[model samples]
Target: MTETTENKDLVQEENVVTEETVEEQAELTVEEQYEAQIAELQAKLDDEENRHLRLRADFDNLRRRQQLDREAAEKYRAQSLLTDLLPVLDNFERALQVETTSEETASIVKGIEMVYRSLIEATEREGLQVIQAEGQPFDPNVHQAVMQEQDSEKEAGTVVRELQKGYLLKDRVLRPSMVSVNE
Candidate 1:
């Protein structure tokens, strides 16, 4: 064969090999692109799932908080009405504490006592309870210490006397007991 023809044939053979290599590389590139797309889609799905979980948890927390608020509202619903009746109840108590001078006054006092007892019973039925302060330990939560007295018999921080009665509505304190504490 002539030198030019031989060189041309060799060049054609190299071109065929290069074409085959390029085809193989194209196939690999297509597969790699599909894999990359799948990975990206999976990551997106995972992110969406995480976001959904977070939103669900937030909604659940909001629901629980609302439920607690509703329960508290229901629990303290009678707070204002009961607070208004406290002064009337105190007056009844004061009247019952007075001494009677004569039989006439004693009968009137007895009638007043009956009315006071009935009122107390009615309040008790409605969950009004007098807070025990006298002779008990002075607690800032249930007792308002208005005066301090030095007493040798009682320990310090002990309740010596209750000046004005305090009350509770259920487990909540409607009024703290006005009391004198031993210092």
Candidate 2:
């Protein structure tokens, strides 16, 4: 062959050999393709693990909310009962209003006093309490000042009298007390 034709053939052969060498050294067959697929599966597994952790955290928060609701239900179970007992307390006050000293009336009064004491004790156990209003400092959040009186003995702005009692239920104010403040 001519020298130019021989050189062209050699160039073509070299190009083909270079392409074959590149393919042989790559190690890119079905097995290496499986490795890439396995890497993708591993990434999916990591994502699933992250989603599982998020689900677990959400479950924990739901459990805490349920626990709080149950505790609140248990703690406030006495509220309805105490609301029903308020009229009975009013009746007791009406009985105290009668200033009679007959022996029979006195016995009835004593019996009513014992029952009242038992009721107060039971209410205390149930978290119902009477707010201390006599001689306490005036607190607008907890006490309603119904009267103001001049007092030289107690400090100014101090409560001198209480017209009604207030109560609290577990750090929450259920009622405010009516009181008289010293000017």
Candidate 3:
């Protein structure tokens, strides 16, 4: 072969090799771009999933708290009205203590006693309970010591007398017992 023809043949081969390399490089670039886009989309999907889980948990907690609050409200629904009626009960008890002078007075007292008993029964049914104070041990949670007296017959810290009656509504104290404690 002549030198020019040989040179032309070499140049054609190099051009073919360069064209294949350029095509391979373009395909690799497109593949790499697709991989990067897929990775970005996956990350976004994962973040959204985590956020949704947190929001669901928050809603569940809120719903549980609200249910507990509603139950507590229902349990204490009549507390206010019961507290207001305590004074009326006390007056009824005081009225029943009056001395009767004649048959008419005795009948009136007996009638008052019947009405008082009815009131007591109704209140007891609604969870009203009398706190026992006299001769019992004084407790700060259920009894208020208004007077302290030195009493040798009673043990120290014992309730000597109940000045004013205390009452309970279920497990809660409506009024603490006003008592005189032995020192």
Tell me the number of clashing residue pairs for each predicted model.
0, 0, 0
Scored by lDDT, model 3 comes in at 0.92
Better of 1 and 2 by lDDT: 1
- Per-prediction TM-score, please? 0.85, 0.79, 0.80
lDDT of 3 by residue, 18-121 (tens): 99999999999999999999999999999999999999999999999999999777766667888998899888888888888999989998999999899889
Residue-by-residue lDDT tens digits, candidate 2, 15-118: 99998978876757666888989999999999999999999999999999999999999999888888677667767867877876799998888898889888
Pairs clashing in candidate 1? none
Model 1 lDDT on a 0 to 1 scale: 0.93
The lDDT values for all models are: 0.93, 0.85, 0.92
| Residue-level lDDT tens digits of model 1 in 1-183 | 699999999999999999999999999999999999999999999999999999999999999999999998887787888899999988878887889999998998899989888888888887889999999999999999999999999999999999999999999999999999999
Q: TM-score of model 1 relative to the true fold?
A: 0.85
TM-score of 3: 0.80
